[model samples]
Target chain A: MNLLKEVFMKYGYFPGCSQTGSAKEYDISLRKVIEKLGVSFDEIEDWSCCGATSAHVTNHKLSTALAMRNIMLAEQQGMENIIAPCAACYNRLIMSQFEIANHSGIRKETEELLSASFQKDVKVFNVLELFLNIGIDKIIENRKRELNDLKVACYYGCLLVRPSGLTKFDDAEQPESMEKIAEATGAKTIDWNYKVECCGAAHSIARRDIVVDLSKKILDDAKYHGANVMIVACPMCHTNLDMRQRVMKRTYPEHEDFPVLYITELIGLALGMDEKELGIDLHFIDFNYKDLVPENSGVG
Target chain B: MSVNTLKETNKLLASFVPPASFTDEEQEPLNTSVQLHRHNIADEISERTFQDVSLCYQCGKCSSGCPVRYYMDIAPNKVVRLIQLGFYEEALKSSTPWLCAGCQTCSARCPKEFDLAKFMDAVREIAIEKGIEVKEKNILKFHKAFLDQIKSHGRSYEAGLVAEYKMKTLDLLQDVDSAPGMYLKGKLAILPHNIKDRKGVKSIFKKTSGK
Candidate 1:
């Protein structure tokens, strides 16, 4: 707890585009959970898009330049550390930092395009990394009640850990960081196969069938492993897994309803925060907190 | 040796010889068919992305782990093979690059540490630059609409992106059921959040587009 307090006194927050619109619950829950944990963050001023999958799919330079602009903003604001809640934004910001520091061609082109000096000074951390730095014991000590009734499958998804050379946080293949944090809240974290599987990502809008097919497999794997709720770290993963269940039910009528909650939302629930306060009520899949908490747990 | 064993050995060796009709002239025509006109696409991709397609040994680990490979017209390993063989047109025309979600599962599992996801990005970029017809037109339209939203507001506007994408691809009816639910949850902000430095973002678009 002392280490957690010392390390994350204040930092920059990059709440990627989805947090404001599609995944508002993620933002809401993250804020409430982090506030309870005594972590503070200042949003980078006037930050633009991190040039997500769309930017990199069509143009390489634009992707690097757009991410660099946010890094520049953080550096100018004197933030030594920045946390990107979205896995895609964190990946792009870290990738851009790596490219600017190592690749001279990208560095020069990005500097020229943004007309700003590239200072690879600010370090980037994903939401999971932030929790890990905050220490699992600290999380356990802060929790007001144990999640005894919750069977959780911690889904890391793709961008958070893959292409290990860039993000370089956890084991890309078999990540246990989410499970470690999840177990600290006293939930039964299941050992699942589709933890790092792709949820069809941005294709949720363009190609609904593919997203439905892939997300269905993930949901089915979680259910088979006895996980009643799927926990995710990325907004994209949440959208594909949580919001696309309707399409999944239509495609496979026998598909059962499974709740998907952000890791922060799960922590908030264990911390005695109500579902409405953590924005868990906003999820597309219905989740009643009373089903999990016991009568004497003191959480209404 | 026994006489029966010697006869068996001779019979087996006899089957190893080529038929009398298979002449050296016939083999020469096979060589002509192998004389394919190869392009320098591998070098071009290497130059842009700093990834060498020649490093791929076609282990098929990338294709096996890919979640969306079933939907791709060409498998990921086959796409790399096409690039290595300098079949730029075939590689560019493949739906594999467009359908790739940049999941990086292939890149993470590759024995040779080939960045196949970045390679897919480079292929998509080069294909768009060369004005090749996009095989996944709706996917391309979605990407374009997403970028246009950023260009206008400096951040993504979900409602505007959906409206623009539907207008472009005429995919209006799909996902319409989810809209009212999203609106009810306050997930869809009707107005865009314009950044203070809109001019800076627009300049980035202009400069990156090489205007």
Candidate 2:
């Protein structure tokens, strides 16, 4: 009676923009880890962007319409559930669902804008929710290598459990879902303050300085709490925390290197997947897996 | 004069103080003209976002929880207060909306259940519509560049977005050192992944933009 196996046999995958570019590791590790778990994902064919923060800030209607088109596409392909790996995409999709369901004006306007019938029934899940659906026992049972040496700071960032009215999955302010999932891999999760802190998302390019400053505080907090590595689910958070470390070094001479790994990558490692196969090598900060394994573990 | 009685006397004195006169006569008069014109900013925001800005009681919870509050010219609570006070231009012209980051933390922790994040969105949209000078030009440039990428390709192209943003803001040479490393890691797609429904995407953009 493996409820996990039956729960997510298939889902519509919305990789979002970063999965193909800035966060390819998330896409790769997600696919590899899920495949090992006997789950399959059918990507929505020719899906467009979800509009993210840009459209929402500039034009609310455009944001809803953009996300609605993807939902419509998933429905057209007959998917009951969708897994948006990026937190921003998941937030936008779910926000659109909430808006369309509650506000008839928005629903009518979105339908008219896209010229498509909006059923608005498809369920959107973030990566954390996807794992929760897969069940923690399944992850613990499938672990090929214990991650005892890994001290993880589960950074939820923002958008994962926000605007509680819309997400409704976990506590918006104090999220423990990521910590629970990270601990399932035998990794010790740190109790840190900046788990739900903002990592200066979407300002990675336009305002790198702010991203650097904000990410520095998060990294500093995690390290101060004795975390050797940080685990993140959102690609934007990963970019700011991991990619911006280069600038951190230049700005603050005391800045030390810190590795940021996607939650899927952590699970992939626990499942005995290779670093290269999991795209861990693609990260900006270096991660030495040999040091984490025990001397006589006979693993890897 | 006991301390409590003195405080009450000061409060009475404060109540008698005349309103500050508009230093710049060229500036539109506050409250009086707004009342007569029936163009209340709070009502406009409420109508646009469906959020009752009147419900905000200046608790400052939104401002305190804001991650980027230090960067904002006006605090989140004060922006809502400014709207409540009918100072729409001040709220619109401030850099608060541009620096919000759309995290929804304020809206989440707000005791009044005010959707401050969506309110910020409405402020930014209205600011642009009214042709107000953007306090944070680079942020707007970045957003425009991002939207342009989506409009052309129906998806966000990081390479195209970066190039367009750099050209637009002329903040060239910023993050140049990291570009090579990102490209090497296969994180920067050289070509845009154009979707099949380009017409559909374009139409969505056109109709929403009111073009």
Candidate 3:
């Protein structure tokens, strides 16, 4: 752990559509946390969507080309590592690198499409993965404020842990990386089975019943396990858990609308970040965790 | 998944079939050509998804771990089995691949390290390519709508995505309750975010999709 000393690493941040739209709070909190930690990042200029479910499901070639464009852009910026806050984009971007590197035919196809050759130069990491590399102890030591007695259920959803060949990170079967990161902020993490469960993403609009059925179960488990706040990394997961509570409640009328915070937002709060700076007020459900933790109180 | 779960897998698969419902076409047609056809489909799968279908040994681990199994017409493991059995038409027609959430649970849980997610994704792709009608109309609409947004602006435009999706599915009032909350929370933008590489995105789709 001696190499854990604070070191400057620059990453090209590729914010998915949700980060600018549904999960803007994620972007805001990410900015605050990274700033507080003295971490520097550059937004990959002219970055495009990673073709999350659409390209992959419809046309495999289209999917690889779209991700290849973003990776090439990051490389063009002289950056070797790129990070995405959205799980869907992160999966696609990383998978794009993997696809173009291993599959010569697909790589040639993509290279022809973009009229640009893809070198196995850039690597993609989710923001959570980036922080885990930064060391959880360093994060804890950097905390300006501690969330004492705040019970949180850390939800990884999917994409962060699967298709192990591409993601190449986290235990696919039972992942505790996010839980460990959340606990570093001085919050209590509830152990739960649905940590890596699917929240029926992208189906939020078309097949909402799926999202309702799936997200409701995740929320119910988190609540049942005494979690007052839910922490997530993917913007899609955040939307299903935070924005779609009203829709989910149609099936379960008694379902309480719980606040879902991004990993960065939780880290920012633990760092004593200004509420507005973290964009905490923009949640669909009221963030009512202040009462759970005594104001300005030290670790209980 | 394992030999230990064979009893449970059989019981589950049995629940779906009516007792003694095997009709005149119900012969266990494992002929020589059928065997060739089976290997042909397996070869096609390997070429498409880069997954060795031979690695699978009828283990139902994929179906057991699938979160959306309750809604699938055939379970995740069964789709691979159907392909391995040369039932390409049956696998393509089934609602299983379309219903897949792409959660990668099946891929993660496969004991043989078979890429079930990619296999299912490839099935959906083949289904579309062959003009097989998807039983899940709304999901198809959603994917088409999502791709449409990406194709035009080189990024997703939420307002445009919703408008186009609603137009395609004709479920205008569907999930309308979440809109007000989403808009009020600043979760949606009225305009699409454009990437300067719009031509690059369009060409990528045009070249790869063969459209």
The window of 10 residues in a row where model 3 chain A has the poorest summed lDDT is A1-10
Number of the top candidate by lDDT?
2
In model 2, the clashing pairs are none
| TM-score attained by model 2 | 0.92
Using Cα atoms with residue i matched to residue i, what is each candidate's TM-score against the true structure? 0.91, 0.92, 0.89
Stretches of model 1 off by over 4 angstroms after superposition? A1-7, A293-300, B1-39
lDDT of 1 by residue, A91-160 (tens): 9988888888888988888888877896648999999999988778878889898887888999999999
Candidate 1 lands at a TM-score of 0.91
What is the number of backbone collisions in each predicted candidate, taken in the order shown? 0, 0, 0
Q: List candidate 3 stretches off by more than 4 Å.
A: A1-8, A294-300, B1-40
User: What tens-digit string does per-residue lDDT give for candidate 3 at A1-300?
Assistant: 433443336678898878888888999889778877767789999999989988888788888888888888887787777789899998888777887778899888887888887654887889778898767987888988778677989898888877776666678767788888888888888887789899998777877888889999999898888888899899889888887888767788898778888889888888888667788888887774465667676443
Can you give the lDDT of residue B139 in candidate 2?
Answer: 95
Best by DockQ: 2
What candidate 2 gets wrong by more than 4 Å, as runs, is A1-8, A293-300, B1-24, B28-38
Please say which candidate is ahead in TM-score: 1 or 3.
Answer: 1
Native-referenced Cα lDDT, model 1: 0.86
Model 1, residue pairs in steric clash = none
lDDT, model 2, position A171:
92
